[model samples]
Target: MPSLTDSHTFSLPSSCSFLISVTDTNPISLAALRSTHFYLLGEGSNSIFVDDFEGVVVQNKIKGLESDDLNDVIMLRVGAGENWHDLITTCLKNHWYGMENLALIPGSVGAAPIQNIGAYGLEVSTFIESVEFIELETGAKHKIKSNECRFGYRDSIFKNDLAGKVLITHVNFVLPKSNYMETSYGELANLNAPTPEKIFNTVIGIRRKKLPDPRQWGNAGSFFKNPIIDKSLLTQIQHEYPDIPFFCISKTLVKVPAAWLIDKLGFKGKVLGGVQCHPHQPLVLVNIGSATGKDVLEFARLIMSRVKEKFNIELEPEVRLIGRNGLIEL
Candidate 1:
């Protein structure tokens, strides 16, 4: 379910299909695993397993959704494996605010912080109070605050040194109880309504119409993180390509749209073998029919190289690469 690209003919490892619990997820028994090395961040939206490796793939089937409503805020605690969108829709159905800007992000709540999944004009970290994860080495559970997670533009500690070392079991977020929405990015700027529900539906509707349904096609959403550049480089690019869209990330860092750069470089909808850039959203890569992990990674590297050569901005992938080292070439 990773959103990188579609793949029906992938040569994946048999471990990917193994499940300790598929019918009712109660954390799989340690005895059942028999000392199998495994790692998990999020499922379905932000990452890919690459190949079917020797390690076991333990699906976090933990499930629950609850909210404590107060005057202007609602604190939500959700299971790690619960479908993120389903939980979002439930929150909206209960008239919860805050998360409206984050509608349609894929994967489990446990996996959200690894990359601080964001869309439209907001990222999940905006509301995250804390993240709960199980330490694999200690066999203990711990909670870390939002700031402690070291959240950045599409990054967090979970995806770095802490990656593959813990199993995220739960996540807590404090959302608004009243109208709260921020429409500052791209298409969202066109929104005029002030209601939180309007903002939520607008984002959800847009994503539903724009991104392909994972059930129908394989993909990991946007493959590459929008490049962050310095002010001088931004000014230089602005002069050369007036239409290049960018936003100031900090006094020293400005975020540039990698998709725009890729499309402008004439890579949009281009296909090679079994992989191709998404036609509708050039930022995404598609498996087309039966693509391999290597095919997609090689194509992605080409785009990254081109972006670096042309703009001097080093592009980084947001998707987590699982399995072996040679799975993809940088």
Candidate 2:
């Protein structure tokens, strides 16, 4: 078995029957995929292997970057395997703009669209022109336009109907020359006369202060998504705790911070076995040392249960958890 302990950001002890790294899409073939169970992996920043996988683990490393500068918009075709933050830095250096607000986000470009990765007030989906992928079963290539992606808050078609069925090879992004700076989220909102460079630096600084370095402390960034609930529920919670922080998504929907709810329950720095809710950010679950898959599941369940009991809201995991066979629900 091939060890997967270092493959994922969570750094859990695990293994797989076979491991394959795909660097070029042309020569690759998945003829045997019909008979064998397989899992696609990128930089593994947003996934955790809880137990030994009973199948093959395909690591996507196809790499390339091409840019076409038009009069009004710059088109970027990025390889799925490219480091996301590095791409952002490259774009900034080239004065491509727009992606500055997403600086310091972990994982590969391929994984970005799947999660509809966003930060501050910008989402990757906003610049996405299209996605190119190869179907795992037939090895056929296909491209889906941005409008067909069904991008939502922390979601996309790749996470739904297409998950595990195709391998994303590249992402096309279109950035308008007249891009405006966004600083509406959290600490970024306080920036005085923000530029793309300023926003980039501030986003990096903010993430570093809030999120633990994955290499030093094993973590999958945010453990749970910020739950978006009905406005009626928000009003009910506000009655008990007046300062309950929330973002109005619409007239009927509200987005509540998961960290606040967990912190209110005193889960920050809370440890069970070897798994601990991050002290600085309660929404992140970290592997203190020698943490097992079961330990992570147990710790996450505890947080979810507490939040549900108090807030009457269900917390869904932001990170993907793999069991012995494949993906498992909390």
Candidate 3:
């Protein structure tokens, strides 16, 4: 483990660089981070950096996972840098049931709120009871309630106002009590999954088979956030596309499959330089060997532009583009 004083920076995906400084697990380190010359603090996982970074990048390395039974619900208090998938399996092994559907989504536990990471029939926000953060200005750790989180589809206040400040220290989750679960995701629909363990293994299996691991491939899963369309507009989309898969989230907002849009628009498996859209799931952008941040940024922009022209509705990226280099805000 690197000591609190040591901070380093390295080139990743080219054209993108973050000045890594601070390994502070102690209160003093966090206080120092609050006053860091560079305000941006990021944890484990890759975020495509923008062009220039004038701020320091800090990664939260606090570690712990503990649970308490609250009669009807079990709450899990997980550390920020906890390996996400490992945490999923750990929940299953302990007989916790709500998070099984969310297995294999990349990034860390701290990021789950920022993206509201979800799959199958589960979203992290629904399970999130609260989040604790070291406020950037105050350097004081304060717990924020779920409603105050300002969560939306693949978005939260963390991405907006707290964009470069608060470092998540702990996340609290409320999980299901009994056997009730949801495995009705398109891939899981036909398969009969009777038990929690079976569901956990099956979900992990599906993710492994469909999505390339970021560890080996150097890619983030599902580069685009599935567009949420109004029901009337969704009807128009369905009529035009017909075969597109969708799920209803509210009376007006329906979640549309980004993979279907990318594949249908013919961007799937298309490679431009070292970057390529994943063959199996078009929404996933891959870094083949040493693709630079510029390559991925341009490809994603092209995809968004194409999707917008084809569908008349713009698609948005789920990943964050730090600095200001690699982003198409349309």
Per-candidate TM-score against the hidden true structure? 0.88, 0.98, 0.87
Best by TM-score: 2
Indicate the TM-score of model 3.
0.87
Cα lDDT, model 2, residue 79: 95
Of the two candidates 2 and 3, the one with more favorable TM-score, higher being better, is 2
- Give per-residue CA lDDT, model 3, range 160-223, as digits (tens): 8877667888899988696477767766676674577767778888889888876566566777
For model 3, the stretches where C-alpha displacement exceeds 4 angstroms are: 1-25, 35-46, 50-52, 324-330
CA deviation > 4 Å runs, candidate 1:
1-18, 21-35, 325-329
Candidates 1 and 3, the one with greater TM-score: 1
Q: Tell me the tens digit of each residue's lDDT in model 1 across 1-330.
A: 233222221222213434343223234454344356654434646556576544555567777777787777888888887878787888878877777777777777777777788887788899899988777666667899998999988889987778767777778989866545687776778877667777777887888887777665667788888988888988898798887888887879878888898998899889976777878788888666677766766788899899889888888887756654312335
Q: What is the C-alpha RMSD of each candidate to the true structure, in Å?
A: 3.5, 0.9, 3.8
By summed lDDT, which 10 consecutive residues of candidate 2 come out lowest? Answer: 26-35
- TM-score computed on alpha carbons, candidate 1: 0.88
| Model 1 vs truth, CA RMSD | 3.5
Q: Write the per-residue lDDT of candidate 2 for residues 1-330, one digit (tens) a residue.
A: 999999999999999999988887863456666568999999999999999999999899989999999999999999999999999999999999999988999999999999999988788999999999998778899999999999999999999999998899999999999997888888888999889999999999899999999899999999999999999999999899889999988989999999999999999998999898898999899998879999999999988998999989899999999988899999
- The 10-residue segment with the lowest total lDDT in model 3: 1-10
> How many clashes in each candidate?
9, 0, 6
